[model samples]
Every structure is written in structure tokens, then in C-alpha cells.
Target: MVTLLEHCRIGPPSAAAEVSLPVTFFDMIWLYFHPIQRLLFYEFSCSNSHFLETIVPNLKASLSLTLKHFTPLAGNLVHPLIGSSKPVFQYKPGDSVSLTTAEANEAFDFNYLTGNQPRDSDDFYGFVPELPPEKIELDSKIIPLLALQVTLFPNAGICIGFTNHHSIGDASSIVGFIKAWSSVTKFVGDEQFLSGNSLPFYDRSVIKDPSGLATKFWNQMSIFKIESLPLNFPTNKVRATYILLESDIKKLKDLVIFKRPTLVHASSFTVTTAYVWTCLVKATAATTGDETDGEGTEYFAFAVDARRRLNPPAPPTYFGNCLGLVYTESTHEQLKGNDGFLIAAELIGELISKKVNNKEEILKDAENWISYFGELLNERISGVAGSPKFDLYDIDYGWGNPKKFESVSIDGDGSMSLCKSREFEGGLEIGLSLSKPKMDAFAPIFFGGLHADDSMPINPKENF
Candidate 1:
């Protein structure tokens, strides 16, 4: 159902500007990893003439200019010799990015794009472009850092897909690039379009690894032969987006507070994460028990952005990964019990509070924790990806905001993606990945917990 229209190279619209930047400690953490990919679908019922004549050209041209500022993106991640050192981000005069254009055979379905119902993962793959392989050099390996695809669904809509090397930057850096590109597209002729914008800071020295956690991270990565991300081929797994409205979040918060009055920092992130973790655990228990005993350990891992949390805070524009992971544990029996909700919330809250209050201590200990965290992730750990803070729906690229935004790659990693509700009401959108059987069991439990009466007392026997 997807047809490729064209595959073209988009280099810096300007003359070749050769540049070489050292991959700092923070950047090294993501080396040898598959690039992160995301897709944004937008429904535009405009005439084909308007789209081809106006939108397409404008988008491609604007992206070219945007890359001029984000020069590193137009380059590659080059690995040094075997006996040499770590990889470095290299940009030569002839460096460029691949941009593919495609067309869908059928009309776009609004419901299918944004619905909560589970759908086949294969439905999304066609829109995503493949990540290019490394261009072998005698002394080094050159890997393309970014690839983009734009697909049109005829009189229905258009989808913009982005695939970027994780080592180039984190979510903040990627999102910033998209925002900048959109800004340029909006004001195509305005020379001042990028004047007031937040330019990317390519210098990775801002992220100070006092404990040399980056080297530890690299050593551990070398220990495992990590796999590449899945292309939009076919998948047996399914994905769905669930929304938690403001009212529903309030009730959940109130429920947790009532059960454990001593709980602190029961914010939206903590509470919502707890609810999802509990549902997954209960669902897994109902179908295929991952644990040998009725009481198995369940881990909840969440990524914390260390930009502002660092002792010598990193610049908002600082490029590369500046994130720390926090993994908390709970037991299946504890989560399935009536008081399980509060128990999970307390653990998540306490960790956040500690990280916020004791940034120095946490950063100091991150080196030792890197290997341990990686091992936990290798297990049955449920972590979160994408933050509501990104406000994905707000991405207006000439054509209005995206109709649906999803972190499609989360499927292979078994992590959930969170985004702010598009309705403007304070809410959260969670993109969860699970087998069909597990999803069926999780749906009712998740909905029922939300609709539970406010005055309902914590009954230990009810859940048991």
C-alpha cells in the first residue's frame, strides 16, 4: 500500500562546509546504537496541485537551510581504527542526508491514525525510511546520522518521518531541530526567521562526566552485540495510544494519596507511570507469568533529563545525550494488592525527589549504576520513552500541527511513549506496546481503575 516516489540527497543548501567535532563523554554513550526514529502524520485535504506546487518544494528547501545551521546532522558518525579510539562525528565538504518521498495507495483514515484501539504494527512501517549503512573507508567507518521520509496519502494527508543517530543528540536536540525547521518553513522568505531562535550548541563539553560514566557506558556496550532497529516490514506485535484526561489523572492522584497519606511528589508522571506499571504486571500475571513465584520483581525505569539537574547545569541548547536513568523495583503481589498503587508511586516519587535534591550524589554514582541499569533493561523492565513536555502536537510545519505523533521504534525496546494530550486539556497520551492477549487483559483493568469511585476504600481482598 505504499509507493516510493523519489529518493534524493539534501545537502546544506550552501557551499560545502567541512567540520569535525569530537564526540564527548555524553555523546559516546549512544555510540554503536541504532538511530531513533519517529513519524508525524498530518491530515490535509488540500488539492494535489497545492501540495506539490507549494508544500513539497517549501519543505525540502527549508530543510536544506535548516541543515546549514545543524551541520552535524548533515554529516556522519565516523568510527576510528580498531586499535585507535572512540568514534567521532565528522562532517566533510561533500556530506549530505537522504530524503525519500513516497505516496500511499489508500486514503488516510482519521480514526486509524489516532485511535486507542490496537492496530497491526505493519501498518506504520511503510512510511518510515531505512537507515543507511556505514560508508566504509580504509581507516574509518562513516555512518549517516540522519534520514527522512515524506509520504502523501493523496487527497487525505501527509506523513513526515525522521530517523536520526542517537549519539548526535537526545530528544531535546531532535525536537529542537524539527522546531527550527518548521520555523524556517513558516517564514521561507524572511531572512530573520532564525535570528531569535535557539540555535544548537554542538560543543558537547557542557555535559561533564565527573565519574567517567561515559567510558564505563562504552565498555559495557562493547560487551554486547546490540541489534539494529526494525524497518517497516512486518510485525506480530500491536501498538495503541491511551489517553488520561485531567479528571482521570486527578482521581488517580486522589486515590493514591488516600491509600498512602505519607506519599510525597505524587505528580502526574509518577502516578500515571504507577497505574500503567500495575496494569502491565496484572496482565502479565493473568496470561503468562514472567516470574517463577507469585511474588516476582517488577521494575519501573524512567529517563531523567540532566540539563537543568546538573550541578553546573548544561545549556538548554547543549547537544547530545544528557540523560540519567532511574530504575525502581516492586513485587507482583505488592502491585496487585489494593495498596499497590501507592507503593509504586512512593518509590517513583522518592527517586525523583532524591535526584532533584541530590544531583551531585546521583551523578557521582551514575558510573557504577550504568552497567547495573543496562542489565536491568535487558530483563523484563518497563520503562518510559518520550515525554509530555515535548508537546509533539504543537509542531506546525506550514500545514497545521501533526494529526498523530508516535515514537514507532519503542516496540522492539518494550517501552511506552508519553505525550501531552492534543485537546489542550491537561492530560497525557501513552503509546503502549504489548501482545494482543496481554492488551485485551490490560484494557478493562486500566479503564476500570480510572472509573473507580472516589470514596472507594482500599480493599486488600478485592484485588487479591
Candidate 2:
């Protein structure tokens, strides 16, 4: 059980003028999707009184100061229900982000909850706060963009969780806000160091939709059920974290190169994702006996940051979503074959190479994005959330680096989360949510494949 301590309304340091940021085509892709949720656990032993006295005040103050720069986070997404005006992120003087403080009972184990082993997915719901209830005003539905929760495990530690509307921003934009918040907290709310270093560029015009993709995407949103709050994830699922050490990643990359001598773009991201994708496919097949016929099509989708890929590249500090989707597909048989990893790697590498090298055609499939993604929702698809480039572990509010970081949104869709490993340099962390049986089947295949000699062919069934 968790006890609600207090609900604080955190806003900017002082009243600021109203601001509105236009939702671009990039943002429309996720306009009605479930909000992204994440949890960062830090180990700090202190009494409840000390926590409320020192930690709570510092976090609240630092967050308020951080909000002065990221005003949209404390704002709302205004979507006209009866008209053609695209959604806009609007911030008014009195707007603030909801910050909920809660205390978990002693029954909850901080260490077990932060471990890499499979844990009940429901265990995390307590740490995630709900977005402010949506409001309808003058034909426009107002949706809160972000909500936060700071949960204390008594004498154990603290877990900070946040849920944000995906339309408000992508990983890059949100991670920037986190880094800034941590910086201010570490310096006791001194934002002087963030002036030019991490200040976000809120100019929405940097994202150009010359092809009128914004209108096309908005039209597509009409078919989606836009929820005021994030949809609840189903139960009977367990979340687990896996790591690909530097050496493990190198082994996978070497195998890909050895199999496909001419292949290009076998970066750590591509190879690691491919290996995990293959394992997931086989693990699912092993448990359900579905797709074992080998003729079914399997899909893998991920997003690429378009900040630098744009025609007139936007600054890395540019706020909002600037992403391009990269979707790939192959036969289940091909992915389950002896050379499955190589095949998956080649397909991903080829597409990534094409996407990155030819920015002019990045949105060639923009018009079909909604339909394409919608179709895969109920299909044999595996998408990815987060990215290793975010370096999430480096985020610290003077409590030392996070003992564990989790992208909880992946539970909504069987998507995986990728980030830099907290303990291993040059390695990657992969988080997955699967049923207990599938997780049971996945563990051996994932770890066994890595331990298998690289010179030998990888057989998922044999690994199991």
C-alpha cells in the first residue's frame, strides 16, 4: 500500500506571459498515443522527517526553477474538437505541473523493485502519478502534458516517476528537461550554469512541414481515440532488464560482419536491437507455438531523431518532437533461422544506412505512417522506446546516479527500452515486458546466445 502525502502544484518561479507552441507533423504522430512513463530509483537512506524537510523542498524549488525555462511542460495540449486547427501546447500564467508525493509501505522492497530480474508489472503503478484531469473549454479539449510522482520507501530510498504526453515532446526533449532539473537541484536551484548549456530552443518553426504532413497527420488523428489520461497497462505481465556488455555487443557485431561481409552500419544500436528482436521472436514462438510455421511476417519499428536530419538542421537543444520512423519487416522463418541474427542485423543496418544517408526521403512514407503503425498494433510487431544516446544514468540530483532506470511505457505495447548501461561503459541496457512464461523462455535464449561461441551458428531453439 502507498499513502498519499501531499499534492504540490509546481510552476515557474514567477508569473510569465502566455506562450503557445504549434504542434508539428512530428508531434502529430503521437498526438493521441499513451503518455510516456519512466521511473528513476535513487538510493538515499534517510528518515521520513528528513526527506520531507530537506529533499522535498530542494526538489520542489529546483523543479520550479527548471519550469521557468520549460514552460510547456507545465502547460496543456489544446486540441480543437470541432475544428481543423491543429493541436497546440499552450501555457498560461497560472498553469503548473502536478507533483504528487507518496510514501510506500514497508512491504515494498526498494532493492527488489530496482533489480534487473523480472518483477510484477503492477508493482510500478504506485509510483506513477496520473495527469491532471482533462478539460473541455470552448470546443477545445485541454490535456495535461506532464505529471510527476516522488515516492519514499521509508528508510530505503526514493523513486521518481513521470508521465508525459508523447505529443509534448520526444525522448530528447524530455531527457533535456530531466538533465536541467537535476543540474539545478545539484546546485541548489542555481540555473546560471544552464544559460547556454542546456536551455531548450522553443521555436516550433524549426520543424518545417513543406509536404503538408501536419494536415495529413491531423486528419488521421480523427480516427484515433484521444484519451484524456494515459491508458492503463494490462496485468499478468512481468518487466525485466537485460544488459549487453561491451564485449557482448562486440561479439554480436563481429558475427554480423562475418556473416554479411559487405554489410554496413553495424553500430552497437543496430546489432543489439537485432539480437534482442530475434530472441523475442523465438521466445514468443516457443511459448505460444504461434508463428512457428515460419511463414508469418515479423516487424520491428524504431524512431530516429530528425533534429540533425532536417534540411536546415535544428539545434540539438530544440524542444518538441523531431523524429523519423524506421520500420522494417521479415518472415518469421527468416528471423528464426540459424542466421536469424545476421539477417535481422542486415535488414536493420540497410534501412538505417538508407534513412540516415538520405534525409531528403526520410518522410517518404509520412502519409502512410498512421495507417502503417496502426496496422502493426495487433500484429507480430516489436517497437523500441528510449535510446542509448540519452545517457539517462548520468542524470543526478546530488543523490548520486540512479541505481536503476526504467521506461515503464513499454508495458503498454510489448516494446523494448534501450539506454546506456548504468554500470558498464560502452554497453547497452534493454528493458522488456513479457508474460511470466515468455520471460522464462526468453532469459535462457538471451543469455545463452551471448555465451555461445561466436564462431558457431546461433540456434535459438538449441539455446533454449
Supply the TM-score for candidate 1.
Answer: 0.92
Look at candidate 2 and tell me the lDDT of residue 298. Answer: 93
Candidate 2 C-alpha lDDT tens digits along 1-464: 99999998999867677899998888888887888999999998878998899989989999998898899999999988886778799999989999999999988999999988899999999998888899999999999999999999888889999899999899999999988888899988655546647789998788877889888877777675333343464678999998887777888888888889898799998999999999999898889776366888899999889888888899999999988887899998888777888899999999998875577878778788877777677678888899888899988888899999988888887799999998878878899999999999999889777767855444333221
Q: Candidate 2: where are CA atoms >4 Å away?
A: 224-234, 290-293, 454-464
Local accuracy of candidate 1 as per-residue lDDT tens digits, 259-284: 76777777899898988888888788
Global lDDT scores for all candidate models: 0.77, 0.86
Cα-based TM-score, every candidate: 0.92, 0.95
The global Cα lDDT (0 to 1) of model 1 is 0.77
The lowest-lDDT stretch of 10 consecutive residues in candidate 1 is 455-464
Clash count (model 1, backbone only): 1
Q: Alpha carbon lDDT of residue 428, candidate 2?
A: 85
Best by lDDT: 2
lDDT of 1 at 165: 83
